[model samples]
Target: MKTEEVLQHVTTPLVNPAFAPVVPRFTDREYLNIVYRTDEAALRAVVPEPLEIEEPLVRFEVMKMGDVSGYGPYTESGQAIPVTFDGERGEYLHAMYLDNFPATASGREVSAYPKTIGSPSLFADNGALVGTLDYGSQRVATATMGYKHHVLDLAEAAAQITVPTFMLKFVPGYDGAPRVAELVRTEITDVVVKQAWAGPARLQLFEHVLAPLADLPVREIVSASHILTDLTLAPVKPVHDYLKGVRS
Candidate 1:
């Protein structure tokens, strides 16, 4: 069906209300990662002994994710957007939580991760050692190193927001430990949503809430997933409390 028709078909409830435009997002992640652990002996075997090994021991722990929360904008909007997480929904706000806009944030909070591959070689006596590897007499060490990314994927409550904004993070320092590395923001140049139904418990706020917005940077938007946590790394105070300050 046409987009307009689909929008038109949506119905409404009866109560026109005004609740806070904020909610809580709780994100718990069991992020599995690889950490590099090197030693003096190993360091001494990469390059010609006598070179300073800027970065030594290295390992890449493939990443895995575990989620366990159900934060959403339900309490505020009262419109169930329907977000399904972990193969199911209903008990949580997964079915109804849509998306967010950290990408549009000018501050652009960053996260880091780790590096994977490396190349090592042995140097000769009296051989000049350059580059980042450590070297000493009677020993070889590693040289230039980096990560060979497997792949990157994105998904949320229900349908994967195919175009959800994102960025890659790498481990900081020369160590390459998976910290909240470089962050990727979608750079939301503009946005527009049209809602057209509502009532009381019996109310619909589809249009009243989503319309009249255009070309807006996504960062300002505290989204449904804001209450979902990790997706939206909020400030120290809970998102709801922050909202209170905004509208107060």
Candidate 2:
């Protein structure tokens, strides 16, 4: 499908404002954060068997423009280490993309999340890693990875999510080896907090958001990442696991 057509088709109901707004830490940040950590794990039961865990270590930030509630971005920064999935070990690299950049210290893109701090690897190796640490601009994250953190209200639908999503997925090979595939993701949008005691400010996801990906034609949210030769992050030196792949 044409890129413009796809985008237009999906953004019919979705709207955005000019300014990048911040999620109110008072109104919902703390409460939502608690519920998410507690409820997020339950989603695994719904995913297919082969997919393993659906939610990785990801951060979702929310923002507002005009009257529209959902207008923001997601910067996925994490790594996939060698793991025995279905009794096999492989690695995976993960990242996320949307129309807008999350409201951050400077409205940075997901790709530029690592620069927020001095961290390196986003995904830590629970056991074995595919390659090693990346100290080069062309580092394809053979082992670990990292991205940015977005603040979300933690309600049902906080930040509307969409595709053209980029991910570096590693999987176990036939002979207990590792293979990589770019897995796409389903588009998602944020919904308002279910509780009324909360505030009037709420993001209505699924119903108000565009893209139908719950039941029908499943969405394959992935985009192959390419290394840019001209751009260099500078100071490509290997750092410790804890030191890399994390943001404040």
Candidate 3:
């Protein structure tokens, strides 16, 4: 490829990219989210600077992708910590583990999503909604909620899902030095909340050295939501550059 063609390339593997360039639109995307309180000191240790923690809260989420524009379907589970950026409340994405490679690749490379490969699933078992995450053969986290016991207001559910999300993007150079370090932000837009509900819920995080989700250690189950929606993820934009003043 010519130099001009290389400059125009959107992602790596110039000839054949891992994922398409089109922004993915999720149809019938399902989410099982449990917000709980955790250790304050532990939250401080994980949450980076420039972001302030409002409460010792963590949202454990398990998402089932019914259909995506370019990547088809996949399951993802992770945690986000409630924080404030520039006095605005938001959630900082701490960890994400999914089952698809293309989605994983694009999430980490094309955008600043903290995505990795793992086995995560969400389904209805009997009268309960079950979400679980497994690293290799060991279980990391499990969350169970009453399957749509009480109706949740559509506006409230939409606001919960559309909150600003922050993520840290870090890349190392070939010389094993810091190449890119920045805080990126994004939010879901054009949301159509098809269904939403709230019910009793419980969460358990097992001690896993690899996944380390248990590090947060759920203290109390604050609330739980089961939301189904069709939405599009807004493009990520860098909000804070960690190495801005240091770089020459």
- Candidate 1 per-residue lDDT, tens place, 181-234, comes to 332223211222111111111101111122211111112111211101143333
Candidate 1 C-alpha error for residue 134, in Å: 30
lDDT of each: 0.21, 0.24, 0.95
lDDT of 3 by residue, 7-35 (tens): 88778787788888889999999999999
- Give lDDT tens digits, candidate 2, residues 146-191: 1112222333233212111222233356976543332322222232
Candidate 2, residue 143: how far the Cα is off, in Å:
35
Task: Please name the candidate that would achieve the greatest lDDT relative to the true structure.
Answer: 3
> For model 3, what is the C-alpha lDDT against the true structure?
0.95
Off by over 4 Å in 1: 1-28, 38-248
- Backbone clash pairs in model 1 (N, Cα, C under 3 Å; residues 3+ apart or in different chains), count: 56
Ranking by TM-score: 3, 2, 1
Please say which candidate is ahead in lDDT: 1 or 2: 2
Q: What is the lDDT of residue 137 in candidate 3?
A: 98
Q: How well does each candidate superpose onto the true structure, as a TM-score?
A: 0.16, 0.19, 0.97
